[model samples]
Target chain A: MRRAFTEELQFISDQLVEMTRLTSTALDRATTALLTADLELAEAVISADDTIDLVRRDLDSRAVDVLARQQPVATDLRQLVMAMRMSSDLERMGDLARHVAKLTRLRYPHKVLRGPLEPMFTRMAEVAEDLVAEAGRIIANNDVEAVPQLLVTDDEMDELHREVFRTLLADDWGHGVEAAIDATLLSRYYERFGDHAVSIAQRVVYLVTGEWPEEDLHIEERMDVSRVEPLG
Target chain B: MRRAFTEELQFISDQLVEMTRLTSTALDRATTALLTADLELAEAVISADDTIDLVRRDLDSRAVDVLARQQPVATDLRQLVMAMRMSSDLERMGDLARHVAKLTRLRYPHKVLRGPLEPMFTRMAEVAEDLVAEAGRIIANNDVEAVPQLLVTDDEMDELHREVFRTLLADDWGHGVEAAIDATLLSRYYERFGDHAVSIAQRVVYLVTGEWPEEDLHIEERMDVSRVEPLG
Candidate 1:
């Protein structure tokens, strides 16, 4: 029974890594669709999101089953809870990727990436993909050391997100309101994709260290700095 | 021991209801701060978010304890798991409200909403507050019947969110790109607030029915229709 429980736990971990890989692939294909106006690829990413969701639901039920049957306490219990949280973060990352695909489909034959913003979206997508790939590695290997690197990647995504906004809000921005809205929403989707990756990494950190990432940073400081200004 | 476990479950439920109430208050004050540009109220909402976080952490630990000690299975296990999910949704709702407050503070002394968008924001806030309040009642009373009403409120919020976008994209839109970006982010915050409330209510629905809301509606149809276009 103990060995079976151990195998169940291993299965859950493997499932999370698989989910992360799917999310990364979805983001990659979605970005490709966004850049190249590939309707087929966009549709593929949109449809593939259901697979990620199904994986999350399966992992969740498995985790719950382990909790019920194993009656795990302490570290074991934490791992089960963290698995649920990681699955949620990864699932949300998948949803964000789907959002990107939907945007690609919405614009269709017309590319959503207009002038000046194209490179930023490209960089955002690259960062998002790297972040999810790293997230998968962390989950698969239980590598706490790789967690900080994910934060740095997220920072890069954040910088790119800001650059997208700067171009949109620039005095010379000629993309008009529709394009601006598209850019705004698309940048946000990519940014949030990075954010969910970071969140999953944080969960791994907590799982390993039993300390929340928020404890290392002031709560106020942890709030999306890009979204708010320093209080007077 | 069974009695103790039952009380622990009740306590966790109470904590969730309390968290819901706090989130509703946060949204209310955040909306007030946004509408009035009341820096003090904005700061109050910002600072109050920490209390909600602390409550969530406490509730999480307690739920973990219940799971570990009681080793609850079947329906009881489901209820505890659902409580944790609800607490998380409430905490996120608080964070969304804080996002609203942060935007208010970011644009302090100058209002974020201007022109025709003003009344729309006001209505969105009211809808958000009402949805969260209903979520709290659902948690406290275990009122699954009220879940559908929350969805109606969410629909109202979705309409307001679309209206905000329409005004932003209108040819007559006098608001500059900066204001448009702010409006975009702000509307999203409120929409997400509604989403989280609906999520909590769905958890309640699941707890009562042992059936996910998705099973009631087509999963693809349930995916945020406002964000995506129908696949051709």
Candidate 2:
């Protein structure tokens, strides 16, 4: 029974890594479709998102099954629950990729991105893909050391996101209101995709170290302070 | 043991209701702060989000404890897992409200939603508050019957979200690019808040009926179709 439980835990980990791979590929394809205005590729990405969702559901059920059957305590329980959370974040990342693809479909041959913004979107896509691929490696290998590099990639994505905004808000901005909106939404999708990847990496760090991530330290401090405050 | 387990389940339910209430209040205050540029209210909302996060952590730990101790199966297991999911959705809803409040802080005395956009945001806030309040009621009473009404409210929010975009993209739009970006992000906060509420309600319906929500029907259909497709 113990060996079976161990195998089940390993299976859940493998499922998460697979989900991450699919999500990474989806984002890459979605980005390509967006930049090149390839409707077929966009459709393929859109259609592929369902697979991510299905896998997430399967992973969640398996996690719950392990919980019910093994009744894992302490570290084991945390690992199982964290797997569910990571799957959720990965599924959301897939949804963000689909949103980018849908934008490509919506604009079709018109090309939603143009001018100086084109290169920014391209870079954003690259950073996002790199981040997810790293996220996959971290999950598969339990590599806590790789986590900081993921944060750096996420920072790059943020910089690109802000750059996109600056270009839209610049005085020399020539993109019409429609294009501006498209660019704004597209930038947001890539930015949020990076965020989910970082979040998954953070969960992995927590799983390995059994400590809260530093970014959450402030919130934990505030939570402590709030608890001591006199009741209103 | 059975009685204690039942009591623990009730405690988890109560925590969810409390989380929903806090989330609803946060959105209300955040919306008010956004419209009035109330720095104090915005600060309050931001600080309050930490409390939500702490409560979520506590709820999650408690849920895991129940699973490990009781080894609940079938309906009991579903309820525990669903509670965790709902708490997560509510916690995310709080974060979205915090994002709205942060926007208020970023702009300081300057209002984010000005002119015609003001009323639209006001309406969006109302719908979000209503949906969350209904979510609280559903959790507190186990009132799955109220689920459909929550969807209707979510639809209302979607309409408002679309309207905000339409105004931003309209030929007559006078809002500069910065304001447009602000409006786009703000509308998304409210829209996502509504989406979380709908998701919580769907969980409630599923908990009661043992059937998936209608909205998921299409995704399941797509998953079926994807399974038969030739591998690329």
Candidate 3:
């Protein structure tokens, strides 16, 4: 019975890693769709999100089953609880990616990202991808050491997000209000994707170290320096 | 012992309802701060969020303790798990309110909601507040009958969210990119606030009926028709 419980716990952990992999692919595909105006790719990302949601529901239901049957205590119980939270975060990451894809579809055939901003957004996507992938590694191996590096990746994402605002606020910004709104929402979606990754990493840290690092849960709150100062 | 478990479950339910009240107040004050440029109110909303966080931690810890001691199964087990999920939704509701408050502080002394958009935002805030308060009532009374009305309120929120984009994309929009970005973020924030409320209400419906709603988990994804079309 005990060995069976151990295997169940491991299965739950593997499902979390799988979720990260799915969300990472969704984000990458969504970014490509945005930059290339590929409506088909965007639609694929949107439809693929249902799979992530199914995984989350399955994971949570399984966790609840483990709790009901095995009745784990202390560390084991906390791990199960934390697993459910990580799934929630990963599922949200998928939804954010779908939001990006939907935006692409909404502006079909017309490239939402243009010229110089394209590279910056590409970098943002890469960093966000790196963060979720690192989070997956941390979960699979319980590698506490990888968390600090994952956080550093999130900082890069925050910087890129701020750069987006600076561009929109610049006097030379010729993109007009519609493009600016698109950029604003797109930047927020990517930044939020990173935030969910950090949240997952933090949960792993807490599960292993039994201590929540003194940092905020969502780093976007502290780094929300992207606020718009009212123009004169 | 069974009586003790029942009491513990009730305590967790009351805590969820309390969190809804706190978040409702936070959203209300944040909107006032944005519309009136009240730095003090914004700062108050920001600081008070810590209390909501603390309540969630205490509630979850207690729920975990109950699960360990009672080893509840079946219906009792499901209620405990659902309580934890509801607390999470309420906690995120607080964070969204804080985001609104922080934006107010970031643009301090500079009103974020101006002129024509002011009334619409005020109405958004009211609808959000009503949704949360109704969620609290549903939790307290197991009020499945109230769920339909709560969803109708969310539809009103979606309408307001769409109106925001319409205003920003209007040809007569004199507000520059900065203001448009501000409006876009603010509208998304309030819309999300309503989404969380709907999430909590859905949880209640599922807990009572043991059936997931046929509608999407987050109405925002379905109602996200506020997409920006590119200009010529």
lDDT tens readout by residue for model 1, A131-191: 9899989988889899878888877877777677778877799878777877877887888
Lowest summed lDDT across 10 adjacent residues in model 3 chain A is found at A223-232
Task: Give model 1's docking category.
Answer: acceptable
Error of 3 at A93 (Å): 0.6
Runs off by more than 4 Å, candidate 3 = A217-232, B217-232
lDDT (Cα, tens digit) per residue for candidate 3, span B1-232: 9999989999999999999999999999999998998999999998899899999999999999998889999889989988999998888888888888888887777887654799999999999999999999999999999999999998888888888888889988897877788888888888888888888888888889898887755444643533323232
Question: Which digits, one per residue and each the tens of the lDDT, describe model 2 over residues B151-180?
Answer: 778767777777887787677888777788
* Alpha-carbon deviation at A210 in model 2, angstroms: 1.1
Off by over 4 Å in 2: A217-232, B217-232
Q: How high is the lDDT of residue A3 in model 1? A: 93
- As a whole number from 0 to 100, the lDDT of residue B1 in candidate 1 is 86
Model 3 per-residue lDDT tens digits across residues A158-194: 8888888888888888888888888888888898899
lDDT of each: 0.82, 0.82, 0.87
Ranking by TM-score: 3, 1, 2
Best prediction by TM-score: 3
Name the lDDT of candidate 1.
0.82
